[model samples]
Target: MRKYIITGLLVWLPLAITIWVLLWVLGIIDGVFVWLLSAVQAVLPDSARASIRELHNIPGLGVLVLVAALMLTGMFVANMFGQWWFRQWDRLLFKIPIVKSIYSSVKQVSDTLFSSSGNAFREAVLVPYPHPQSWTIAFVTGKPAGEVGDQLATLSGAASEEHVSLYVPTTPNPTSGFFLMMPRSQLRPLAMSVDEALKYIISMGVVAPASDALSAHPAKQPAAAESARN
Candidate 1:
């Protein structure tokens, strides 16, 4: 009886969690629609407000509106005029001191993550962490550039070869973790895609990447002995 109950839980737990998360997100987005509806009600004639109230009761309407708004914004931003306007708007935002720092940092990260030409988090890799004989999954964010690259090279005692910047995201929350700089040669590059590696990390190794997907470059196996102790 216990075994059967455990098996059922194993099957349903993920589904339950997934549904809960979707509903949570939906509720947040729906709040925006609720605010907009309230504003419209304040401005509209009584008859029009009555019609709008009926539509407000429709479930998932906010999601559709939000998605449509995003799509429209994307389309609007794909042109030269939009590009110029965006630059102007960005400059305006940057003049606001406190907002400038927060917005710019977030914008840079978003651009790196979402830009078509960007290579951030494109490759997954394996590196030794904490101490030797232990390994962790990491994402190859990019090659360290300019002053950062030079400083890292000096610190690593290998100024000639390039160093890579990696992000080692924590399990379950994958949002917070360490950023590492290491030599390309010293790191073992993994064959797993960014998505696969993310699943592995978020699941805390419970969701392993495919066996054949575990290939490493330069060195066929991870070299825990040679891993940088930084």
Candidate 2:
């Protein structure tokens, strides 16, 4: 009976969790849309409210609208006039005292992450952090070009005039992290794919690569060491 129950759990657990998560997300988005519609309905004509209600009743229309809005925004930013307008708008926002603080902060974050020329999360990398033997996942954002890299190289007495800025992201949540500027040679490349590395990190060392697993488990070590010696 216990064996049967365990097998059942293994089969059903993932599906159950996936369904619950999807339902929860849909519920939250639906709630937000309903609230916004209600707010607008107060000012809308009774005939218009009928159309709004009909639109809301169509499943997944809210998500479609959100996707369409994002696509439209991308299209707007692609053109010459939009680029000029964006700069002008940014200048105007900068002149406003209180708004400048908030606007600049948000703009910096968006530009760093989303701009085509900007170098955040450009290349995946591996970095040793906290300790020499210990390592963490990182991304190679951009090579330090212009005066910054040159000044650093001169100050450090480096033979090469190159430096790079790397963005190190924490697992389970990839949004927040520290940025480090280091010499290119110091960074090591990992054999595992990004998804595999993420799974290992998020599991907090419980999940390991096949090579690592062989080294860790006692039963496998003697054979592995013998093979290495040969």
Candidate 3:
């Protein structure tokens, strides 16, 4: 019973934290979203005002704004001038002792998880979740591409297997979760189809996949690992 409670905590706590962090980031973006709406109303020509008003009245505007911001940021960085300015800005942050630690760490991680390339979210895997003592399911999103791949290699002593980008989905709702990247060697590969993994995860281990693949391997009982000792 004690172990069950502990495991349950391990599962739900990370999900809660991931959700809280997501909401926090969205909250910040939402503020910007609102500000942009007001700016659009104030600055646009009379002919554009009605469309701006319509946009302001609609739902999910914040999500749209957030998407637009990311798209614009990506577009900016892709150009040569934008790339030059980005490097300068990046270097300036790196020069700051405390800021560099946070900035670079976030940059490397974001690059690995979010960089657009390769086949993202193609496979399901099992790994220690929240901590190594417990386990959960994740999807193989993609690998680090281009310069991000180089950065990952430099982190290790020598050239090594590329880190696999992953999306660790939450229980009950498989959509929202954490993004991760770890060495391919460290992963405990699972044979379960990605769809099967999603069903198992969404059910919180209640609806197991109708396959003996997981059961046949006693040692690699990843689905069972999320059972919280039942």
Candidate 4:
């Protein structure tokens, strides 16, 4: 009985937490839809209520309807008319003082992260951080570009430096992390897969293994040294 209990916990613990988190998010979104539907019902006329009221008939279905509506709206904005309208809308948004700063910052990050051509989160790399010889797992967020690249060249003393932005995520919570920029030569590419590296970090060093090949490998000696200068 004791052996079986340990096995059961090992099997079900991850699944239970995963399901619990997902359901919690879904419940919150569902509540938002219910509130919106209620508001619509109050302002809507008797005849017009038929359309929105149909949404309330299906249990936990209003959120699905809202999601579909949002997708369709996005598709419409992706068209030609949407392009012109979006620019006008953005111009208006920038006129607002406090809102403009927050909106613009978020927009820039979203564009960089979601752009098809961007190189964010492409690889797992090892970097010396906090101290020399101390290593940490980091994701290559992107290569510095534009004015940022120009500035890095002066700071790093390389006219054409390879500066990469990395996200050094903390343990257990990968969503929040430290952002850093370092020369590419300083970053050592890790042989481990990203998923394995993430698991190692989330476990807070309790679940990592020594890399024999990586630790043992050394630079090859020059072949000319063997032949001698004679």
TM-score each candidate. Answer: 0.88, 0.71, 0.44, 0.79
Worst 10 residues of 4 by lDDT: 213-222
- Local lDDT at 167 for model 3: 89
lDDT tens digits, residue span 47-154, model 2: 889877776676666666678888998799789988888889889999999999999999887888788887675555667785679878777777776787767778
lDDT by candidate, in order shown: 0.84, 0.74, 0.80, 0.80
Full ranking by lDDT: 1, 4, 3, 2
Candidate with the greatest TM-score versus the true structure = 1
Give the clash count for each candidate: 0, 0, 2, 0
Q: After TM-score superposition, what is the CA distance of residue 51 in candidate 2 from its true location, in Å? A: 3.0
Query: How well is each residue in 30-140 modelled by candidate 3, as lDDT tens digits?
Result: 677778888868988999888777765555669876799889998999999999999999989999999999999999757755666535555678877788799888888
- The total of clashing pairs for model 1 equals 0
The residue ranges of model 4 lying beyond 4 angstroms of the native Cα positions read 47-54, 191-196, 205-230
Q: Which candidate is the best by lDDT?
A: 1
Clashes of 2: 0
TM-score, predicted candidate 2 vs. hidden true structure: 0.71
Q: Rank the models by TM-score, top first.
A: 1, 4, 2, 3
